[model samples]
Target: MANTNWAGNIEYFPTDFHQPSSTEEVQDLVSRATSVKVIGTRHSFNHIGSPTEVFISSRNLSRVVSIDRIEGSVWVQAGITYGELSLVLDSEGLALKNMASLPHISVGGAIATATHGSGFQNQCLSSQALALKFVLADGSLLEVDKHADPELFQACVVHLGAIGALVEVKLALVPRFEIAQSVFLNVKFESAVNQLMEILSLGYSVSLFTQWKGDCLDQIWVKRLPSEPSPDRFLNGIGASKAQQKVHPILDVDPVNCTDQLDIPGPSFDRLPHFKFDFTPSHGEELQSEYLIPQPYAQDALRALHAHQSAFDKHLLISEIRTIAADSALMSPFCAVDAMGIHFTWKKDWHSVKAILPLVESVLSQYQPKPHWGKLWAMKPKQVAQSYPGLSEFKKTIQKYDPNKKFQNPFLKELFED
Candidate 1:
C-alpha cells in the first residue's frame, strides 16, 4: 500500500472493520454491537481507543447525497475525503472556504476536531455544518442543526464521536475560486507578521508556512476570487517580487532547488498543506501539538516560542503560526474568539516531546490557549471545561443524546464523565 498520513504515526488496526452502506445499517449495527468506535481515515495520531468488539469504518458510506447550489449547501456521506469533496464541488462551481494542509483527511474526521486552514476570515471546518445526521445508539437517525435541536446541534458539531455516529454532513459552500501561491526566504519575523496581516486583509484566503531552523520566514498562498483578475494582472507587483511568490510547482523538485522560488500557480488545496515539498521527506518522524490562542496574544506567544528555541531546537521539526476568525461551534477551539494557532512538531523521540510539552503548555496557559481536541494535550477534563465558555451547556446536550456513553473512549470518558 502507498504510504499514508504526512505524520506516518498511526499503525493500530481493529480486530474487525465494519463498513455499513447506509445510515439505517449504521444505526442497526450500533444498536446491536456491544461496543464500537467510529473510524474515519485513521488519520489521527491517537488510537481510536476502541478496546471494543468492533470498529466502525465509514469509508463504504461515501456518497454525495444532495446539493443545493442556490442555498450553497451539500449533503454528503461522512466518509468522503476533502480532496474528493473539493473536486466534486469544483465541478459545480462551489467550494469550501478553507481546508487544512492535506486534502486526504475525511470530512467527519476534520470536523470532529475542528481542523482548519489559516485566514483571518476562515473558521474551523466544523463551523460550515448546516446540519448533521447521526445514528444514535438506539438505532434511530437524528438530524440536528441550529433550528432543529439547537443545544444538541451545538454540542455535537465537534462531538468527538461521543454523542453518536455521524452518518452524513450538510456543509455550507462558497463560489469556487483560484489560488496563487508564493514562497519568501530571509524575511524578518516581525515584518512577515505585518505582511501576513496585510495579505489576509485583502486576499480571499491566505497561509503562512515557516521552518524553525532556517532563515525561511514565509511560504504564502493566496486565493483570489475568479472575477478579480487574469494571471498577468494578478502577478504584476505581488508576483514579481522574489519575497512574494507561489509554492505548488516546486513541490516535487529537489529540496536544495526548492529554496526561495516564488510565484507558482496551483489549486487552493495543494498550497495549504505542509508536505508539499518532497525535499524534507525523511526529516524524521515527529509528534505534533497545537493550541489556539486569541489573536491579541499572538505576538507574545511567538516571542515566547522564540525564547525557547534553544531548548526547542533539540527535538523540534518546525513551529507554525496561523490565524482564523471566531465561530460559535460549541467544541471549536476558535469558538467565540479570533485566534492564532501555534503548532509544534517535535522530533520522534517521545521522551523529548513529553518533556517539552508541559513547558509549552505553561506558556500557552498564560495566554489562555484552547487545545485542539484531536491532538495531544496536557489539559485535564476540568481544564478543558474551564477553557470553553459553553462547556456546561454542551454537556447537558451530550447527556440527552448519549447518556449511556456508547461512543465514549478512554480519552473522551476521562474528559467527559457522566
Candidate 2:
C-alpha cells in the first residue's frame, strides 16, 4: 500500500485502493463500498481520508475538462496538483489568485480544508471555487454552484471529506501577473508587526516567519504589484545601509532541496504560492497547529505566544504568521472574518503538542479562533459552532448531501455528532 503525503505522518493499510478513471467509476465505488473515504494527494495532516474497508483516489482522473477565457474560469478534475495547474495557467496568462505553501498539494485536498496563503488582499482558495461536482454516497452525481443549491456550494467548499466524493471543480481565474519578493531580516518583533500591516496594505501579500526565540523577528517576505518599483523605499530609508544589503546568504538558498536558489521573474504562479525554500529539513518530525483569529487580535495573540517563548522554544522549529481576507466557505478557519493565522511547527513531539494545545486554545479563545480543518485541533463541537457563524446553516446543508454519515471518519463523527 502506497503511503499518503509528503509528511508520511498519517497512514493506513486499506482493504482496497481504487483509482477511478471516470465519474461513473467513482459513483460505482461509492455505491458498492460498505465504508469508504476519498483520498486526494493525501496532503492532509489528519486522517480525514482514512477508511478501513475502501479508499478511493482521483489521481488518475486528472484532466482539464474545459477552460473559458471569456468567463475567466477553468474546469478540472479534482485530483490535479497545484504545480500542474500553475504550469497550465502560465501558458494561458491566467492563474489562481492565491495558493498554500506547497504546490505539490492536490487542488481538491486544498479546497477541502479551505487551504490558503499569506495575503491580506487574497481570499482563501475555496472562495475562488465557482462550482463543484460530487459523487454522493448513494452513487448519485450532484452539481452545486452559487445559483444551484447555494448552501451546499458553501458547505462543500470546505467539506473536510464529510460531504461526498469530489469529481470536478470549477475555479475562477485571474489575469496572470508577476510579483517581486524581498526578504528582510533582524527586524524587531514589534516593529515587524507594524511593518507587516504596512507591507500588506501596499503589497499583494506578506508573510512573517520567526523562530519564536524572542531574539529577533527574523525574515519578512513581501510581494507587491509588479508595477511598483522601489516598493521598499521607505523601509530602505529607515535601514538604508542594510535595506539594500541582503542579510543571510542562506536566504537565497532553497531550504528544502538546498540546490536551487530562490529567484523568479515572470509569472505570479512562479513567484507567489509556496516559497521555493523549505526552512526546516532536519528539524525532525513536526506537528502543526494553526488557529485563525480575527485580524484585530493578531497583536494580542502574538503577545501571548511571545510571553511563553521559553516553553514554546523548547519544542518549536518556528511559528509563522499569515493573513487572509475573509471568506464565506463554511468550514474555513477564517470564514467570514479577515483573519490572522498563527501556526506552530512543533518539534516532532506529538505528546508535547498534545499537552500544550489546550493552553494554546484557551489563550486564543478570547478572539474566537477557528481551527484549521486538516490540522490538529482541540476545540469541541460547541466551540466549533461558536467560532463559525454559519455552522447551523452548513450542518443543514451537509444533511442534505450526506445524511447517513457515510463520508464521516472518527474525527468528523466527533465534531458533527451531538
lDDT of each: 0.68, 0.74
Who wins the TM-score comparison? 2
lDDT tens digits, residue span 324-406, model 2: 99977777877778998888777776778778888888877787688877777776756675557677777787788788777
Give the residue spans of candidate 1 off by over 4 A.
1-15, 47-51, 193-196, 199-202, 214-284
Model 2: residues >4 Å from true position, as ranges? 237-264, 276-284
For model 1, residues 1-418, the per-residue Cα lDDT tens digits are: 2123345664434555678888888988889866678877756655433434557888887888999988889999998988778778878877887788667678888888888877777888888888998888777888887667776677779877776889999999888765654443345555555444564444555555455543335444444444434333332334323444324422333344232223344555544554442333432267777889998887787767656666666776655667878988787888789998887766677667778777878866789888776666666766775677777777777688777777776767767653
**Pairs in clash, predicted candidate 1:** 101-273, 181-246, 182-245, 182-246, 183-245, 245-263, 246-263, 246-264
Candidate 1 is scored at a TM of 0.85
> What TM-score would every model get versus the actual structure?
0.85, 0.91
| Highest lDDT model number | 2
- In model 2, state the lDDT of residue 122: 88
Worst 10 residues of 1 by lDDT: 252-261
Q: Global CA lDDT of candidate 1, please?
A: 0.68
